[model samples]
Target: MNTIEEEVPLGRRRRRRYSVEFKAQVVAACQGPGVSLAAIALHHQLNANLLRRWVEQAEGNERFLVARSEVSVPSAATPAFVSLPLETRNARTGEIRVEVRRADQSITVSWPTSEAAQCAAWLREWLA
Candidate 1:
């Protein structure tokens, strides 16, 4: 006979340590095509917010590694966006604007709506 136990999120539970391999796997899965972070986290039995934090850490580490102690980096990571207090329901449709420069040309692209997952995926691919 097989018995299954349900997981319960306890209050102030003990800290769990994840291996580098496991973290890498989770990060990669979260960045995979058509894969949402929430879905990946759920599938791996992880907290979605924790996974997001890991992604931020991984991205920062990746940047440092790429620089290889040659290039200087800022002391603080700047915020990618700022909040606006003014609000208008009669405003134009919102779009996430993206600009990419390569070789001698620059291209700007905009995506309609606030589709964060799609934006993240596009940015990852474009930067890679």
Candidate 2:
């Protein structure tokens, strides 16, 4: 890891310059199956964000592509939305009922469904 440590001004942190070979090696490790970028960064004593940038940059470089081809890369798949079934509720006589129970005491309150927003606000305030 041929890093050159140059002197910096006061209040400024020293910047590290990693060799091209070292960056390529780290980036290749990140491309492995089931590999964690964070784990690789921690293992190499590198910032996670900096390692991420190296991987991104390596994706566009031919040298990295050749190295990546040596490993089996997973195919990227497009994400699909799944529809969920919603529970049906009766519209007639619609009401919101809440039960509050404390030690040795319980209270049940029914509020009109039309005032659900106000009911939510009241519950928030009461709970807080």
Candidate 3:
């Protein structure tokens, strides 16, 4: 008599545990500016969406969330900088200025500040 082996469900596949340092590295790279989530995921041979989910979990922890909220929270004493307008006119001259704005003031710099704002938005949305 021939016997057929039962197929295991996809969800039952073994779950892998990443090292703390490795996970931190992935999170750091994900948090870094000008680095696309897709690129980071691809560099690690992972799905972009999965890395995104991991980011959500990491940011959800109480301590981290609180710390982030402090920086992003719109307070009477603080201003919220939403985004950095990309300067296309001076692309050839490398004259892009990263606009850091709050409710009260704004400053321009040579590097992009979108990373912090984007991360805050992601966390806020997750919380909501």
Best by TM-score: 2
Q: What lDDT score goes with residue 52 in model 2? A: 92
Give the clash count for model 2.
0
Candidate closer to the true structure by lDDT (higher is better), 1 or 3: 1
Cα miss at 103, model 2 (Å)?
A: 8.8
Span of 10 residues, lowest total lDDT, candidate 1 = 67-76
TM-score to native of every candidate shown: 0.39, 0.43, 0.37
Rank the candidate models, highest TM-score first: 2, 1, 3
Tell me the deviation in Å of residue 74 in model 1: 34
lDDT of 1 by residue, 24-123 (tens): 6567665545568998789888899999997788788975234333433223334567888986432476776777889999999877666867988988
| Residue 81 lDDT in candidate 3 | 81
lDDT of 1: 0.67
lDDT against the true structure, each candidate: 0.67, 0.77, 0.61
Q: Tell me the deviation in Å of residue 91 in model 1.
A: 37
Give the best candidate by lDDT: 2
Clashes per model (N, Cα, C within 3 A): 0, 0, 2
Question: Per-residue error at 39 for model 3, in Å?
Answer: 0.6
* 1-128 per-residue lDDT for model 3 (tens digits): 11113444687775455544455456566775555989878988777887898688778776544444444322223355889889566456544455667999997655234455665665578559
